[model samples]
Target: MDKKKTLLTLSAVAIGSVIYNYLKPVKSDVEVIQDFDLQKYLGKWYEIARFDFFWEKNLKNVTAEYSMNEDGSVKVKNEGVNITTEKTKTSIGKAKYAGNVNEGALKVSFFGPFYSGYNIVMIDSDYQDALIFGDNLDYIWILSRTKSINEDRKAHYLKYAKDCGYDLSKLKWTVQEG
Candidate 1:
């Protein structure tokens, strides 16, 4: 009887852990750009700014390639060159629309053993620039197709970032080389 109770308790604990991890809240105050047009947004987006992460640290010439997949999802190919090691790593994933036209979000996952979060927090009217967030606050990125963005556009995004509770000082501008 004691052994059976122990097994049941362990089973309950294991189930609870799985549920906790799966149902973890990853939402932030950042609003999804509702006016996002997938057609315009689909392309090679250069990393303009990002919150530092180990995999992306000291990485340069980073860009995310997006393509439409037959599975009714957007294929994501994130490639970057490690400045320190001069090595390139490419991670492949897929994303689907999760919000409406005006307030749009995306859920992306690598063809992994498990799924992860990839949310779109903000985007420009022309879809020329965007800010993305992931499962945690640590995952933040600003992307643009061009190496440079207009001053006014930058200002607008910065304001949005502030509203989203991001520390402006923590935003590291990606170094683009011509």
Candidate 2:
């Protein structure tokens, strides 16, 4: 009888923990701006830094261009030169407001019906720099209007990302030319 009671109590505790975690308000794992103006954000952006990802391996001079689509979704064009192959590669994708248009959270699909989170966590008032993070916290990108950002600004963003529990060591500094 005691063994059965102990097993039941353990099961109850495990279930309780799962429920509590699910009910808790989400934090750092995924944070986005209150409102993101797609029009104001449209244009060219340089990839100053990013976490290592298979799609962009050994790439340099990375750039992303955002354009408005007639269907109300955002068109994304990413271009980069393969350092080893000396060839330019491009990937086109589409993005839509992940939850609501009022939030900076977006769902970007590179493949059909397969979307991933593209949350803009921080952006400068001038729209010159932005910190983009993924919902799973495995992806991160520091983007700028120019090919490079100032050391001060880079340091500030690094600190911000670290505070948010990102592994800064995983970042790959991008090289770009004007």
What is the per-residue lDDT of model 1 for residues 1-178, given as tens digits with 9 covering 90 to 100? 6999999987887677579666765556555656666778788999998888766788898899999999878898998888888898888888887656444677777644345556677677677887787665556788898988878877877887677666778788888788
Query: What are the lDDT figures for the candidates, one per model?
Result: 0.76, 0.86
- Across residues 1-178, which tens digit of lDDT does each residue of candidate 2 receive? 6999999987887677567546643445756877687777899999999997888999999999999899999999999999989899999999998887877899898866666779998888788999998765578899999988988889998998999888888999998965
TM-score of each: 0.77, 0.82
For every model shown, the clashing-pair count is 4, 0
How many pairs of residues collide in model 1?
Answer: 4
After superposing candidate 1 on the true structure, give the runs of residues whose Cα lies further than 4 Å from its correct spot. Answer: 1-26, 99-103, 111-113
Q: Lowest lDDT 10-mer window, candidate 1?
A: 110-119
Alpha carbon lDDT at 106, candidate 2: 90
The number of the candidate with the highest lDDT is: 2
